[model samples]
Target: MKTFNAKVNVTLKKSVLDPQGQTVLEALHSLGYKGTENLRVGKYFEVTLNAQDENSAKTQLKEMCEKLLVNTVIEQYEVHLS
Candidate 1:
C-alpha cells in the first residue's frame, strides 16, 4: 500500500451568501487593511490515506469530499495530492 496525502479546500459557491466572511471582511477593513478584498472563509482538510495507487487515492478522496467534506448544494472543493 502507498500512503497518500490529500489537501482539500472547501469554499462557498459564488452565489452563496457568506455571513462569516462578510464579518471578517468588515473586521479587516477596521484594522486598516484597505488593499484586500473578497475575503471568503471556508474549510481546509489534510487527509492521509493508504491506497494501492494514485488513482485509488483520488477516487477515495473524491468520495470523501462529495459525501461528507463538502456541501454540493452551496460549496465546492479542490483537491491537491502529494
Candidate 2:
C-alpha cells in the first residue's frame, strides 16, 4: 500500500450565510484592513491514508468527506492529495 497525504477544505455554500466569517471580516475592518470586502471561513483537514493507488486514495478521501467531513446540504468540500 502507498501512503497518501490529503488536504480537505470544507466551506459553506455560496448561498449560505457565514456568521463567523462575517465576524472575522468585521474584526479585520476594525483592525484597519481595507479593501477586504469579502471573506469566508472554512474548515481544513490534513489526512493520511494508505491505499493501493492514486485513484483509490482519491476515492477514499471523497468517501470520508461525504460521510462525515462535509455537510452536503449546506456545505461543500474539496480534496487534494499528494
The digit string of per-residue lDDT tens for model 2 on 16-80 reads 99999999999999999988898999999999999999999999998999999998999999998
Segments in model 1 whose C-alpha atoms lie over 4 Å from true places: none
**lDDT by residue (tens digit), candidate 1, 1-82:** 9999999999999999999999999999989998778889999999999999999999999999999999999999999999
List candidate 2 stretches off by more than 4 Å.
none
Report the error of model 2 at residue 59, Å. Answer: 0.7
The number of clashing residue pairs in model 2 is: 0
**Backbone clashes in model 1:** 0
Which one is best on lDDT?
1
**Per-prediction TM-score:** 0.96, 0.97
lDDT of each: 0.96, 0.95
